[model samples]
Target: MVNLIYDKSPIFLQNIFISLKGIQIYRQRYNKVYRKELKILNEENEFNLQKKRFKSFIKYTRKNSPFYSQKLSHLKKEISMSDIELLPMLTKDEIREHVDEIVTRNKGLLPMGTSGTTGKKLIIYSHPYDISRRIAYLDYFKAKHGVKKGMKRASMGGRTFVPEKQKSHIYWRHNYILNQLLFSIYHASNENIIYYIEELNRFKPQSIDGVTTVIYRIAKYINKHSIELTFKPIAIFPTAETLTVTVKSEIEKAFRCKVFDQYSSSEGAPFIVENDKGYYDICPATGYYELERIEGNIYEITVTSFYTTTTPLIRYRIGDAVELFDTLPENYTQSDIKIKRIIGRKNDYLVSNEKGKVYSAILSATVRKTEGNFIECQFIQNKMDEVIINFVIEGVNDKKTIEHSIKELMKVRFSESTEYNVRFVEELESTDGGKTRFIINNLNRELS
Candidate 1:
């Protein structure tokens, strides 16, 4: 009802509402907790800081969370950094099944939703301290790349804040309180995209952040049309999806700035952000991370986020993978933060003339329902109007039933006119560096 009224309102009114909403939530995120974290961003001796937070997090989890209390009943109240290994590693399914018991607090929690890129939909709760500190880490990351506190910034997010019935070229809303322009990804069709570029030219944002593929699409259009942007941003921070080498290079070329590829989960996972020196460094202050080797230095990530106080994520396997520097101590800690590459989320997209392009962030919706049914699924797009769901089943799930479920999910992201070829494959092939890409879009061949 409120959403309906807000959507039906005029653009000017919508902007005002957006700002009001931003104002209400902005202070909560940038409060004393955030300021304190900012003050300590450059503080040295992170090993000590991590040691303190990690031990405290474990004790807190054991006492407050019913699920963890039972799981870690064997451990003493006082636990050391070395004792972390004894604690069990948590998977998405475990968290989903026991979320009620895992959660420490019942009230004063903020729900953070992930699109289930790993074929699971999850709502992670953030305590006030958790959210505030998280925002601070992100802002501190921007500070490294010359972003100021109150600088004019543009953001491209996956939210559909704009009404579908609207028929205007304008596709963004400005929050004067934060001096930020929020651009809607759903509205950035190939034709109406010019308005977004025009707004960027006029607003002159110092920095840009949001969904990677949407920003990539804008960069692609700018370069294709040879459009000269008046204002050059200091940097671009692409999140929510993977950043491919070609996409990063293209965006940097178009914007005349560096693209800082960041790695963090919507579930408030620890940060592995790109520094100004173009090196990916794991932030020790955010959380304690464990890199268990899957095969020869290529390791799977398990994070214990301090920010998830409302819903503690101790040794949570945040289903992303990475490669680390070969030279490291046997019992490595956060102080030894040497990350070579973040081969995390599937770095692929399905192109569309009407919708521009839908990347993994949005495409992940199709498989959220069929979680345990398949080992992994790959989406192959040969044309703009059709996509093939080639999946490797785990057991005896009916192919037609799974396809029907995915077909329903597809209608939400893509046009109902689009076609799908659902197939059961023996095994899906891996991409470069053994990364299993969920999307294999051959549209680039057509475009080239």
Candidate 2:
């Protein structure tokens, strides 16, 4: 049975419930033991450990799960990364189609959904074990940054804690259970922003976590208005969206604290965070990852979950891109995987004439699935009813093939009256964070 109460519960109560739930009890025990292992396990050792765990997981799925059993019936018993590569890539569409068959014979099943940066909502499954590890992953980084559990903190992501159209001074909801102050991002108007800052001052959270753009808005407001804060937070963790250099810099200056960025998905495949050493490091305890190069230096991240038993997301191709690092720093001899930048996930959007918003992820997936040697691509939307696709092609014998494919997909998803322009660009540009912006929507004004 699905419980909507837990899904919409305050973050603190949800965390408490996870610790007390049936399967989660064992998961908590397992995590208590595994935390010790995580301390000594270096990047290389963690890879080997996850490799062993992955093989076991595959065997478990093949014996029980109808989806994997049929998919891997022909493969040999000995599983290798190269051998796994031979298997068909799993997309979000496949999960939506085969959700019932993908689930394992496990209890404490939980339904989860992605924020849907790709235009379409993606529903995935998880269990107590998965949730435990996820919380632990963030806690590990929190500990590194001198943040402890039960401490005063504030979060201002996509959640609508405060309802819009309600004229009131209260712009936040207090969660006394976790000593957390939940701010609303939907009401980020000039008038509402003052209440948000006022609440932060009154509550005096030790740390703040929020969406990249939302937090940047608060920081920009502080700088522009010269609004003096009563208290300074120890650290700021920006998540959900790409963290640009300008956003990070402005946030650090405004809050007088460090910014720690992180990346992950609802699929529970791989957990990654900005380490204290200043690099995007994958949490070895979370899952295994295989990087598939889609274009020049830009690779699509494929992941397999090690924690979840209800859903086996093996070799799942999440529609996000990242840039690989060529060399490692001399001091960092522990990490095997080195990632310099995360280009971005599909989070761009388009607005219709009637103010209907369309996700950029829909367009990104369409072009990515096309059979062509496109080196790089970006979707730019300046007007409400128009779109410009800026793409870089290495060399294609039939350029018309690419154009036809894009237009064909566009026609199906968008209105016939919408104006579409395909522009062939020599090179795409990167953001201040040294990462490429896949979806650029200038119409959605940034914080001044």
Candidate 3:
């Protein structure tokens, strides 16, 4: 019944319904507790502030969460800063098996689902307090770049508001309460891109936010068609995917504005914000990050988010990895934890007959050949020796030249014996959450 109204309702009424829903989220996200978190964003301390947050979160979890109570029972009730590492890391499987026990609060909880980009998806619960603080942290990052509350925002999130059978160029809905213009990523195909560009010009948004890949696709169209937009956004903030230098450069060139990249997952991990100087700085007040060495300079991210007290993420293995300096730096939460590239999922890698296994970092760089004359591509590796490349080429570009270049590049990376089948498609498919997955490694988990 609700689905019927959502699909059949007029755009104005739909916007009203969406805004009403936004009011519910706005209350939870921008409350009194969020105001305090915004202040903490600028609080000065050498290291004591982050140290204090960790201890408080640990103390709260140890006292309230039944799972953590027994898990950390052996340690002193007052776990010291150094003893943080002593706490066992939380995995997705463990959280799934013990969600009820892991949650500290039963009432006033919000359930956020993980994207499962890494093959593991679970529902994470958050208290209103944590949810508000998390929003504060994100808003603080946006504010620094001139996107404040109530400003018009054009977002390309996973909003499937438009019915699939609808036949029209109109692909967006407005949320007036938050002053947000929600664009449908589902309808962002090449044919519908003109509508997006026209609507964006008409809406004149102050800032554009959402999935990095979705925005990248749109930017490619603007550049390919040489379409000049009338309204320039103050900033383009891309989330949920790894941003290569090449991808960032193209987005900036298209919008004639700086791209501020920020990182946080659906599960509410700590914020890794790209500063004005283009460095990815971990916001200490938001969470405590630990690295579990995978090999060489690559390490998986484990976090203890301060706001996730409802479902404590103490030493949680978040399934994403990053490249770091040879000698990792240590500091109290008062300072920034600088990071290099955010590599792809820890389990995301392609099998190479010669190279054995090519992880996401290498694969990201490998796809850099699509910088021009190609919008985007997804690599589907179903067999060790066979790989299918599905890509969308720029409308005016020569297809033969792009195909030859891609196959030639893959030969060097995957060896001469490897099969590289490249095909051109009008629209590339997105992940379940409306994210453009660069690679989908479907090889059996145990084998890969």
State which candidate has the highest TM-score.
Answer: 1
1-448 in candidate 2: lDDT tens per residue? 2245665565556545543452434445346544654454423366677667777877887888888889888989768554666677788788877988888865667887542443333558886666656666676678789887678999885543333234566656665555666776545545457778887888888899975655777788899999999998989998766887777889998899888888886577677788776668887656777776666666677877777667887878777777767643333322546787788643365554432444443344455445555655666777766888766876766467767777765654444567878777787655556655666677854323
- Which pairs clash in model 1? none
Greater-lDDT candidate between 2 and 3: 3
Measured with C-alpha atoms, the lDDT of residue 38 in candidate 2 is: 41
Of candidate 3, the 10-residue stretch with the lowest lDDT total is 329-338
TM-score for each model: 0.85, 0.69, 0.76
lDDT (C-alpha) at residue 53 in model 2: 71
Question: Candidate 3: what lDDT?
Answer: 0.76
Winner on lDDT (1 vs 3): 1
Off by over 4 Å in 3: 44-46, 329-336, 345-448
How does model 1 score by TM-score?
Answer: 0.85
TM-score of 3: 0.76
Per-residue alpha-carbon lDDT of model 3 for 93-183, expressed as tens digits?
8987899999999898888754344322367998788878888878888998988988889998764577655777788888887899998
lDDT of each: 0.79, 0.67, 0.76
lDDT of 1 by residue, 1-448 (tens): 9899998899999889989988887988889888888887767565677788888888888889999889888777799778888989888788777888899988887777554553335667777888888888888888877887789999998666767577777889888889999998766667767888999999999999998878988999899999999999999999988787888989998999999999888788888898767668887777888887888768888898877888888888887888877745777656675877888543266776567567777676446544445556778787778888887776665676788877776764565778888888787756566755567766654342
Clash number for model 1? 0
